[model samples]
Target: MNTIKTDVAIIGAGSAGLSAYRAAKAAGAAAILIEGGAHGTTCARVGCMPSKLLIAAAEAAHHAMHTDAFGVHIEGTVRIDGREVMARVKSERDRFVGFVVAGVDAMPGADKLSGYARFIDDNLLQVGEHTRVHAKSVVIATGSSPVMPAMYRALGNRAVVNDDVFSWDDLPKRVAVIGAGVIGLELGQALARLGVRVSVLGARGRVGPLTDPEVRNYAERVFSEAFRFEPRAQVQAAVRDVDEVRLRYVSGADELVEDTFDYVLVAAGRKPNVAGLALHNTSLELDANGLPVYDASTLQAGAHPVFIAGDANGVLPLLHEAADEGRGAGTNAARYPNVEPVERRAPISIAFTDPGIAMVGARHVDLTAESFVTGEVSFEDQGRSRVMLRNRGLMHVYVDRASRRFVGAEWIGPEAEHIAHLLAWALQMKLTIDEMLRMPFYHPVVEEGLRTALREAEVKLR
Candidate 1:
């Protein structure tokens, strides 16, 4: 066995692991990264990038089909070549992965190991083929994988999960999406737009259940035109036959219905990849969800030298949050000798759909804040939205009436992703509604919605 020593050893070369590696190297600490696959994590390869590409293509096809609605007549019928679209998605994903790999290689005092990494002890990890790495601090950023319910194990080949959804050679004529979360909604809408009949079933009363009620209502209204959405439905099992994959679900009435589809997509969420890490050798504790329990500030797993980041720790498992957690963990690990830890900041969550969804800080109902006021502005009133012909969504603002500060903001509309960053910065800086509203906002732009929302909030305060 070859033994290697480093100041920090990061397992998983995904977004979180890569971020940690860069932070450690910049802090003058020797670090190494290990990944099980040659390609990067789900976000880069399967989950986010490729899925979004397909979604974009589907949107284009939708526009082409509906050009007549905007007074633009198209002579030919719009058609989507699923195989070609998938090929483009794969190419873009591969390019992004290559860029990530090259960037990792360029980092100083950082090495990459291509194999599965397992914990030998608290401070030691063993990769494939007797490659032992020792470190004073270890960060588990192994991320998460799509959960395949045991009920669908028998329908393995016929069912697809998030990680493999982008690799389909041909789009199914009918797809039964077994979740109503972000992934399921995004995929369901994209496939539906691609001319596939999509049915989304979930236990929640609406799609994107984690989002605010207002956002969920809008999404349900918009997507229901093309998708068969069955909320408050629990899937019991999936059976595969020669012709189709049949899903049996119990509806709110406790009646079972068997829906037949050409394919079944299991997007019910994900589980942490901690099974092979041998965490039992150390004092690290697992939460009820089978994820590593760690201190929010330090990302340290109890008293153990092992640290956790990304989906492994299960703290706001978005890619951006994972990167932030990874950087904090690496910085803290470098200063482990001094026991100085980084303070964790709240994260902003964004969902990318046709009309994006963005949220930052606590909602009015979620906070114990007193003297707070809330305001909302519809995108239908925004001139920019009218010009873009995408006038569908709303912006909501939560203000602390006592301090007049902008405490939180949520939006569902065009450019919501870009506008959410501004909200996050304003919240972090504790900017008051008065201060935000006074700023000059460009007219006929989505950002104008912010000013309009804040102005309405000021009126409510008066």
Candidate 2:
């Protein structure tokens, strides 16, 4: 039996776990990373990277077909080779995983162990056969897995989730995507652009219910033009036989309808991955959803010197948030003797769609400002959006008239993702609307939309 000791033992090598490991090492603590599967986890292998690659490929195909609108005539028919796209996506994913693995391997005083890890005691972990690691503190960053609805169990390997979307060799002739969240809308649009007759069914009022209502309306409009969107629809069951999958749902008037498609991709949502950790052995307690209960401040599970980060804590499953939480947990775990819990700022959520959606701070309804003011600027008014032929989007800003501080911002347009960081910074720094507008912004760029939005907000305040 091989026995090892470290100051910190981090489980799962995903974004959160890797961040924790690096943070602990930088804090001069000995850290060992234990991963059940390969490094990089779902984000690098299947979730974010591969899915975005497919979306980019679809965008390219869409642009090629629509180039005629820009006075460019195509000599022949436009085609998409799914096999080639999958090959490239997989190659890039593998390259990214390799780079992450190499970086983890080179870290000082850090050992990467590959195997299923389980808790043997409070601060002890057993990784595979005969290897035991005892650490003063431990961090769990197991991440998450897509929830497979029971009704679609029969679809099995045919019904893919976010993880296996890249493995699809050929685009389906007709596909049904269950769920209208971020993954569903993004993948649904990607498949639709690849010539698949895509139908999206959701139980919510809009595609992205988690986003602001304005953002959801814009996303619904953009994606509905490409795919069949059945909002406020409840899915009852799915049956797969031979070549096609059948989906049954209830429509507006309680009318049951059935839709048959070549394939169905389930993207309902994700649950925390904390099942096999044997958390009961320690003082760590799980909530009703079987997720670890941690202090929102220190992220500590209990008095067992164990902490939870990333999706395991269920505090927003975004990669950036997970990374930040991991850093906090790692630093706290390594310096538990004297470190104080750091305050976390609110997170910004951004979804990548045709128009792209970015949200920061509180929504309009969440805050109570004496003079609530809002402003919007259309992408059609921007010279850059017009020149790029991507003119269907809007930018909105919210301000507190009394304090004059910028409270929130929402945008659905070109370069909206890049502009969101500025809004997040302004909200974090407590910058006023007047202060933000005084900053000089370059003309003819997408950022001009922000300046315009602030200017319009000033008028609304009056």
Candidate 3:
């Protein structure tokens, strides 16, 4: 076996791994990046970019068909060519993936290694059969993989994951989506708008990542009206029958209903890609789930020279969080004995379904009702939303009663992705409700709705 020595060894060439590699090198440490899978990051290849492209297409179709509300009349039906749609999605997706791959290609050849890596000890890694890597410190940034339920294994090619959706040559006639989280809602709604018959089924009464009960309930009702949404569906069985998949479930009326679909897409969340790493060989402290116990601030695993980050750490799975964690982990690994905690940005997340779903800072479940005041605004009477015929949403801002500061917010509304950013900045600055209200409020704008909510919170503060 070939032996290589380095200051830091990064396992995985995804977003986190790449960020760690650069951070380590910038800190004057010799770092080697190893990967078994393709070089392109998940966002560019399958997760964010591709999914957005599909959503964009769906939005166009949905808008063209619904222009009647704005008194804009179309001569006839808005037709969607599935072949053309998939072609552009695949083409544009490949372009984004190419950019990421080009960046990887520009890296030093000697610093790059092929094949999966396994832990031989705390400081040693066996990379496939060819290389034995001995590093002073190690950073695990292996990212994540989609979780497929055991029941779906019997469906063969009829069953798919979010990763498998982008490679399609044409959109299926009918799809049964399992999971009502971000991925499921975004893709499920997008597919429905594109004229594909879609049924989004969830076990629990959950809608996206909204922890606010009011927001979640409002979103569930809105989406159900928009498409075939069953947030609390109880699916009995799913099996492959020749070409199509047969799915049986209990409907709202408590009646057994059977449906056949061209495909069953599973968006049942993701698990960290740590199982094959042979972590048992290492002495790092592990959690009950067999994952390494690490600090979110430092990304350090116990008192060892090993660190975990990004999806592999399973703290926050968003792209920005992964990049932040990777940079912290890499820098800490480079300066092992002199590691420092990273001050992270306030938490923020968005789901790109129209009207978008977003959350900033603390979640509703994290805040107690007695400790905070909830200020709300409904878009039904908001100026801009009414003019745009999108006056169907609710916003809730949580303010700490003691501090009177804006702690967090969860909302389902038009331009939610944009609104969430403004709220995130306020939370990061620790702005009080009164201070936020005194900032500014422009007229006939969606932000005016935010001002209304803040003003209400300000009144409660008095």
- Give one clash count per candidate, in the order shown: 0, 0, 0
lDDT tens digits, residues 245-297, model 1? 87888886688888889878888888888988876766667777655677777
User: lDDT-based ranking, best first?
Assistant: 3, 2, 1
Query: Highest lDDT: which candidate?
Result: 3
Predicted model with the maximum TM-score: 3
Worst 10 residues of 1 by lDDT: 338-347
Give the per-residue lDDT of model 2 (tens digit) for 18-53.
889888888999999888887766777887788888
**Candidate 3 structure, TM-score to reference:** 0.98
Inter-residue clash pairs, candidate 3: none
Question: Model 1 Cα displacement at 1 (Å)?
Answer: 2.3
Off by over 4 Å in 3: none
What candidate 2 gets wrong by more than 4 Å, as runs, is 107-110, 209-211, 252-256, 343-346, 369-371
Residue 43 of candidate 2: its Cα lDDT? 76
All candidates: TM-score: 0.93, 0.93, 0.98
User: What root-mean-square deviation over C-alphas does model 1 reach?
Assistant: 2.4
Candidate 1 residue 72 C-alpha distance from true site, Å: 1.0
lDDT of 3 by residue, 1-462 (tens): 999999999999888999999999999999999999998898988899999999999999988998887788999778899989999999999999899889889999999999999999999999999999999999999999999998897899898999999999998999999999999999999999999999999888889998899899999999999888888789889989898999999866577779999999999899999999999999988889889998777999888999898999887899999998889889999999889997699899999999999999999999986999888999989999999988989999999999999999999999999999999999999998878887877878899999989888888878
